[model samples]
Target: MLFTTPTFAEEKAAEKTEQYDPKGPILEHIADSHYWHMFGEHSLPLPVILYTNKGIEVFSSHVFEHGKEEYQGNYKYALIKDKIKPVTEAGEIDTTVRVWDFSITRNVASMWMGMAILLIIFLSVKGKYKTRAGKAPKGLQSFMEPLVLFVRDEVAIPNIGHKYKKYMPLLLTMFFFILISNLLGLIPFFPGGFNLTGNIAVTIVLATITLITVNFSGNKNYWKHIFLPHIPVWLYPIMIPVEIIGIISKPFALMIRLFANITAGHIIVLSLISLIFIFNSLWMSPVSVLFVVFMDTIELLVAFLQAFIFTMLTALFIGMAVEEHHAEAH
Candidate 1:
């Protein structure tokens, strides 16, 4: 055992001094960045978009050289912990100027790839449907039909009721988009590494859409329930504020739920993988690999479950907002 320990360790015992920094790399992998990492020092640098009072500037993120040095264009900017900020010639960050970044980051690229995959699959499926109308689906069509039907019939119809058709498109889009993004994030390679849905911004946007849909589709009865709440006149002062808060809270809940769940899964898997390096033991690899595979399989199930819950909850909220007075009479 002693003979093999020194040769097989990930890091020599003499060099292994730290307690293993899991948060640093794990957060990097799961967070948005201007480049897609391939291996050590090898990455695909994306374009950086910035708007400053001076003017708009566009450049390749490679100028930052993976955050080693500042990128000086017509303006000077430094990649400070994956964030680009204007810097002075002395290599100091210039706080005097305000800059807005709308860069196409790794997460954004992953989202685009996920969207492309969706288009390819659905477009092909649509073509197949036209060619094989009313017949049993085969191949990819066979694979997708049940999933589509589940979202349409199981999610949309039951929750949104008769008006479900109008919202079917939105719900279906949410389900497949979240599903595809979640699945793509698990790949840990090109076109799939970044956590798009796991990003709070993306989840916030989705939650906002659901919020807008519910409010816009709300009927007279729905508004009455919020403002007037079928409560005593004396309770109006207390209940009105709660109702208003409830509207914002629902969507907020959606945002946090999806973000936390997905982010936690990613962190857990990364933590397990980090164990091997932290211990510098090849013996740990088998155990680490087994746990990772097990966690990944569980994450796959979570990917589907989360998508379903988000769509289902959205439909339920929309239904409540647009429901007729008679159906809600009881």
Candidate 2:
């Protein structure tokens, strides 16, 4: 669920020996991409939606070979140093031209796919609730009912009080969206390798939404506490700024927490699996495989843990905002 950024140690090792740089491909797998990988050297193409001085230029990512090649559209573009850039007729990058990529990359596609899955699941469960009102929940209904109830009973009601109902839809949506996206990244194969939640862009959007929701839904008392604290008048100048920073800090923490947790899991799993190639020996396979199995089990737990932490923190923030009094929830 994270994009690869080369670490100082990795860069130093690369400089020492120009051989078997496993980190590059590992990072690419957990990164935003122009194609959906099916397997080795094969992938499904995504459309490049770019707007430039020439006009709206659209093309298939297949036209270029995994950033190793270039394509000519209204303007020529090459994937240079992991970025798509415009190039001159001589195949040199033309810094003068500006290219805006609004392309639907793999991560974007995975997000849409995850939402579609959620829609199907909830719609099916809703239909079941209507048809079998008093009966025991069956199949998919049985599976999802407990999770839905857990968030409401454990997260929302305990934190947000009676006003929990107003935010259930948003909370449920966030929880499942994150859970599913994290699970999708664990698949490591076709239709699932895209790292949606690990992407800072996606996490930032989620944090921003939570930020907006908290501030907007906050009551008069909330603002009063932030701007005019319980402290003395002389401390107002210092306290007010601190309180204000707290507001932004909550969401900032959320963004970093989710991104780091998810990305780290992917890196650890990939690094574990890479030991075999690094050794270049048949004997390393047994130890590497066993360790990888252990890591995968841990990652499975993390997939759910991250979702729970994110949702719980969100509920806690909302609780802090919408409470009318120091002791009261709502």
The most accurate candidate by lDDT is: 1
Residue pairs that clash (backbone atoms under 3 angstroms), model 1 = none
Q: How badly does each model clash, as a count of residue pairs?
A: 0, 0
Per-candidate Cα lDDT values, in order, are 0.84, 0.83
The residue-by-residue lDDT of candidate 1 on 39-132, one tens digit each, is: 4435788989899887778889888876777877657889887899889989888989799998998888878889999999999999999999
Q: What is the per-residue lDDT of model 2 for residues 165-199, given as tens digits with 9 covering 90 to 100? A: 99999899999999999988888667777678888
Would you estimate the TM-scores of all the predictions? 0.93, 0.91
Residue-level lDDT for 97 in candidate 2: 93
Candidate 2 ranges with C-alpha deviation above 4 Å: 1-18, 326-330
